[model samples]
Target: MTRLTALLLLLIAIPLAAARPTIDAHLHHVNFLHDSDGLETLLDAMDAADIEAAVVLGLPVTKKWEEDAPREPRYYMGDEAPVYYYSAADPLLIAALDALPAAQQRRLYPFMSGFNPTDLNAVEHVRRMIEAYPNRWQGIGEILTRHDDLTALTDGETARANHPALIAVYRLAAQHDLPVLLHSNLTSKRERSFIYLSELEEALAAAPDTRFIWAHAGTSAEIHRHQGALPKLGETVEQLLKRYPNLYVDLSWTVLEPYLLDQEGRPDPDWVALVSRWPQRFVIGSDVVGRFGNLGNIMHSFEPFLAALPSAVADRVARKNVQALLPGQAAMPLDD
Candidate 1:
């Protein structure tokens, strides 16, 4: 093609790239042992989706203990039946990133999550890793406290967000200026009600210095009890956001149906206004696990909702908000 033609094509391609640039505040590094794909898959998917940066956390607790348990296809959360677990200290995630050249790693903001929250020494476990690879680690968690179905699947002693052991972990995170991405389901997973949020409120109150990302905006996976329609959680979400300046919201796939969009894939005006009220407090997360077969379309899944938002509000929630939180933001590329 001629230079003039090539330039024209380049100009056209840029707008198709990112209607609004985005930072995936939440995503996972698929462990190749049990998953369909791994780090490279995620990297490629992120690029295709126009996701500029992603916060990748390792699974903190593994299901290795489920080895002797008989598999029951009828069990709840069946896909998560615990067969094997890579420990909280597993080097597999870091190793994969280490294998990549510097340019590739820049697109990823890795966080340390593979630590036992209930262990008294959990604080030390995270600290040692952070110290060992100071530059590699930017945040902590996706810490599973009240997560549905998976709660029983874990081998370690279960603890709530406000448990003493976790309190210590949060303190350690604050000391390092590492933001903690907590996955304490806002309400009871069974009841789908706002009963358990106080546990989160307690944790937030205790760790005033820590920046906490409330994954799924406290929403959990849908269960049989959801009764066809879920509660409108926008007001509850606003209350929490209003109460905690240190808190940020992760609007992951778990909340796509009830919290942000409707059955027709359109944005809810109330939800949009709630998010727009504090656009900086919210960020988009693909919430993909161990698979990138569809990651490219995950962030774009929110396009209709984003389109409904004011451009400035949409861009902030999509990209700039999370960018402000990243530790190595200065080194990341700003180009399409």
Candidate 2:
């Protein structure tokens, strides 16, 4: 072809490539012993959906028993199964991904987890993971922040005093310029205040450059109970967003039946307005785990919520926003 024809073809192709939707920034891939195919299934779904990339988090479930304890935690044996926990850096995670083709590997981004942020070793572990796979991984998170755990941190009488370990991890994140995704939730039954907000604010203040992505929008309590009052939680989120430029929220695990139980059986407009104002500060996530039954239900529940969103706004929340946060990674196609 002549130079003129080549130039014309190049110009035409650029627009077509720019039209594709980028990727889903937050996707959970469970690698239970018996279910080795979970990651493959998730990748297939991403391909079918035209999702260019996905951040695959490793969540290992295990059982823990107190030292020399006569009886194990009673809750484990009941209707709710008890499983011990593991971090994202477990060897099994690398092993699982090693089997995939290089192209698929490039499409997946992994993040290390230190379930207990208070552990000193957790800090070192995360730092090493970032150093080892500087490009393949983007951040450290999916850190568990249970009510009991926070209570123990603040409790003077408890054996486990405030460790300052999470703070240390944040420091490392700040130094490395990586975002830290926290799993914070409302602890108390009362509606007056959220317990961990103060601690989180302090951490952000200490590490100004360190970004924090709050999973589930810092929602600890059931959403149904707060139905018409969804806006009530806005005050906290609004304050944090304004105060911390690096702070972000994820719209995941928000579509469960209990969380969507308003009189209209729809999400509150107040909540929508809050997010709309700062669409760049949020990302779409499925939080899918377990077999087809669980994954199917989660997908079913989230589709409508996503569809209900305004097209332009949804596009930003679903993909664009996340790409902006991680510039080193590939950017999403604008046209799509």
Candidate 3:
């Protein structure tokens, strides 16, 4: 091979190799039954896809379906029958992550969950887990509230972000300097209205110190299931970001599909501007629940939308911003 040809190839490879990882900030490692995937498999998938890191959390709520509710949720990926209620406990995640080798452990950051959010003691429960895995625990949540079918199936009062019990939990998060990832759907399947957004805004005001990762930007599959009139969330999100400096939006697949993309599958220029305007306030998430088969593709889906953004802004939304939110010890180094 000629020296000139090889030199040209090296120059092209250098920039590609140094590109940042597309972090999946909202993936689920555990659901009702248990931690379904092994850590090594997940890491290998990330490596193949060039995902530098991900925020791994167990679903805190176990769903209990009504007798009439179908055994398998229509959109669920796992082969098992749909869980009527998500099993409650953090042990699955804790035990799963604890068993990982030191090097593999560095690829994923663990977030505490597996507790009832409405319990006044939710904060203490999460705190105990944090203390148990000092270097392991980085954040708390995927806290399910006003969830679509889950809320419908739940027998008791569904927890809201503004609820005093959750308020207490936020206080605990603040004390520990940990970020709280909240999944409070803006509306229920039944109502199809923006009734619950006030609840979220109130909570954001109450705990000014707590950094929140708002999952799905209030979009959920249940929202689609009922197929009722919806609020213009894009405008609402812009306002919320302006109002709450502590809040970060998780642009998972739910939003990535219709909201962030145009009918033609192009990145909505408006979204590009919103992200670029507040580069540090937005992060991308795969929203994969207890499944990693498509992990790489899920993270990769955001690339086209990201490509529409400016270079530096694209890098921040892709990985760096979310890494900043992770605890110093648990956050991974950037590819650059």
lDDT digits (tens) for residues 1-336 of candidate 3:
422233324434343333357888988885454546777677777887788888988776554334665564433333333433233456677677778887777778788776676778776777777776675678888887878666554445777889888898888888787888999989877675688999999999999988899998888865855763255677889899999988999988777766676655678887888887877788888877676776766666676689898888888789888888875524333334
- Count of backbone collisions within predicted model 1: 2
Error of 1 at 47 (Å): 2.0
Off by over 4 Å in 3: 1-20, 63-88, 190-192, 228-231, 328-336
Residues 1-336 of candidate 1 have per-residue lDDT tens digits of 522233324434444366456888888775323343767777777777677788887676544424555663333255555522345433667887888888988888888877777788878877788877766788887788876667776655666888888899899888877888998876554575677778999999999988898998877655423543356577888888889888988888766665576654568888889887887788888777678766656666677788888888888788887877765333122322
Candidate 1, residue 279: lDDT = 71
> Across residues 1-336, which tens digit of lDDT does each residue of candidate 2 receive?
522233324434342222335455556565332233466776776654456676666653344444655765333232232344455434556666777898888777666663455566667877677666665556666665643433332312221112377778878876776677676664433444555567667766777777777777666434323432334466677788999987888766552233332333466565667777776777766565433223323333344344556776668776677766663543344445
**Which 10 consecutive residues of model 2 have the lowest summed lDDT?**
153-162
RMSD of 3: 7.8
Q: What is the TM-score of each candidate against the true structure?
A: 0.85, 0.72, 0.84
lDDT of each: 0.72, 0.57, 0.74
Model 1, TM vs. native: 0.85
Which model is ahead, 1 or 2, in terms of lDDT?
1
